[model samples]
Target: MYVQSENPVEITEAILKMDIRPKDLIVLLVAESDNLNLQALIDRLNEAGVSFIGGIFPGVIHNSTLHKVGVVVKKLQSVSAPVIIQGLNTSDYRWPDFTPTLSGLEKKVTAWIMIDGLMPNIASFLSGLYDRLGDRVNFIGGGAGSLTLEQKPCLLTPNGLLQDAAVIALLDYDTHLGVKHGWKRLAGPIVATRTSHNIIYELNWEEAFTVYKNYVEKDCDCKMSPANFFEISKCYPFGISKSNAEEVVRDPISVNSDGGLVCVGEVPENTVLNIMKGIPENLIAAAAEAVEETLNQSAHNDYVRHTMVVDCVSRALFLEDRHEEELEQISRRIKAVRPEVSPQGMLSLGEISSYGEGYLEFFNKTIVIGSLY
Candidate 1:
């Protein structure tokens, strides 16, 4: 359920009033624009002895609408208590072992991962997580942070709101995953010569910003400044090449002082990239395609318990008013399968999923759909 009241007291009251089971875990996907005192809300929940794990995102999705000021509270059953991991911004850290936690569970499990979107070592952390868990457990989630691009206490937990941290929980529900980004390649295979975590210092042995600026300026017939970088770069994102698959997009959120490009996720050194562009119609179509892929992945999926969408916030920014069309497409397709389930999720900073049972990845300007059964 989604709550529109920004008042911390009212929100807590709504949560407490819910007919939640003793073991049911609550998820709070709050909108960044609400400007609520998250600590106060957390304090209220703690006082009431309620357990929850979630974050503040750029926006929340309820049904087919994108709400910039509200809370999307999800009650998850057959799920384990959340495990919090810190030091995501640093390079060296150990992923917690979940073997003991899952030993007693008889059914197959899926992991819901929520990380600090602005953390630099997101790819590294995810890689470590996948290595530890492997494909034994399906993974689906997205990065959470504000659109302001400022790192702060955004992620909520039993302790309080924290930064540079991650919350993970294991769910017993079976999930069908579909990942897609309708961005077509407009410019070619530029190599990132130098990169550190999420910062690209060089492309083809030159300044990353300089190379990016040249292509975008010539194509769009306009100059780019730090002031207008986000406004213009939203239309053009860099895509990392993946063999025989859609290019994994990386959103360049800002330009750094050293002429580097800071992306939402990491860009490894020497990785080939492409400048990608998308039309509103194509993006909307891709949303439907994601639903089709998820529904088609399993033949016996006659009943869907719930549908969760982790769509890119940047896609909404680019599509503008037409973003509703994208959501509507997702809604229309899901309704065809199970009319009872409505798509509910957040407009994330980065989307996460195991690509076609391949491997876990963090993506930007992409949509990840998970149908729970």
Candidate 2:
């Protein structure tokens, strides 16, 4: 069951009115960057013995309509355990301490993860998790942050609100994952000559921003400047290629004073990078394809409990007015295949999934769909 309301109090009231006691709940909320009172809302849900895991996104999908400011609550029937790990900034971040807890769980488990989008060491965190869990658990989730690109206490846990931390909900159910990013290479197999964490200082021995500016100005016929970097860079992102899997895109958020580029994820030194581009039609088509892939891989086609979509907000910002069309495309495609499955999603800062036999990755400008059975 799913419910939506602009008022948090109303959301709690509606959940209380339900006759069924939900084993777990997932929340997708849209509120002013500074106005979100997650603690108050969590307290209300806790009083009723309702456990939940989710975060505040720029916008949320309730049914087929997208709401910029509201609460979308998904009542999950499967039993779940929510775990919160703090101190993501500490250099000693380790997963072995939590290995015993995860090993004690049932053999079959699916994890939904939400981490701080602005955390500098997201790649390290992901590597640690994949090393510990391996293919034993299926993963699907995205980064939780504000549209302003500021790191706030957005991720919600039963303990309260948190920042620079990650939350995982281990579900006792089967899930099928599908991922797609619809971005074609614009130019460059250029090498990243210099980098520090998430900032790229140089590409092919030239200043990173200089290389990027020349490419954008030449391809798009638009003059590039630091003030207009974000507006122009959204249409053109950086793609890191892999041998067998689709390229992982990194969104350039801004340009630095030293002519470096700041991206959503790390751009390791010596890594090959390509400028990627996308359009509305291809992006919508990719979303439909993602739905088809998920349905094809589902274990129980006759009874899919729910479908969750974590699409990058950069795509939404790029599509602008036509963004709703992407959602409608996904809805139509899913309905054509499985009319019983309902889709709900959030426009995330970044996306996560391990489709087919691929390793889990944190992607930008991508769409990830997961179907639970």
Q: Using lDDT, give the best candidate's number.
A: 1
| Candidate 1, superposed: residue stretches over 4 Å from native | none
Q: Candidate 2 on 103-193: residue-level lDDT in tens?
A: 7766656777888877877877887888777787788888888888888877877788878888877676678887888889999898999
Candidate 1 weakest lDDT stretch, 10 residues: 88-97
lDDT of all the models against the reference? 0.89, 0.79
As for candidate 1, its clashing pairs are: none
Listed per candidate, the RMSD to the true structure in angstroms reads 1.4, 2.2
Tens digits of per-residue lDDT for model 1, 107-184 = 667788899999988998899888877877778899998888998888999888888999998876878999999999
Give the clash count for each candidate. 0, 0
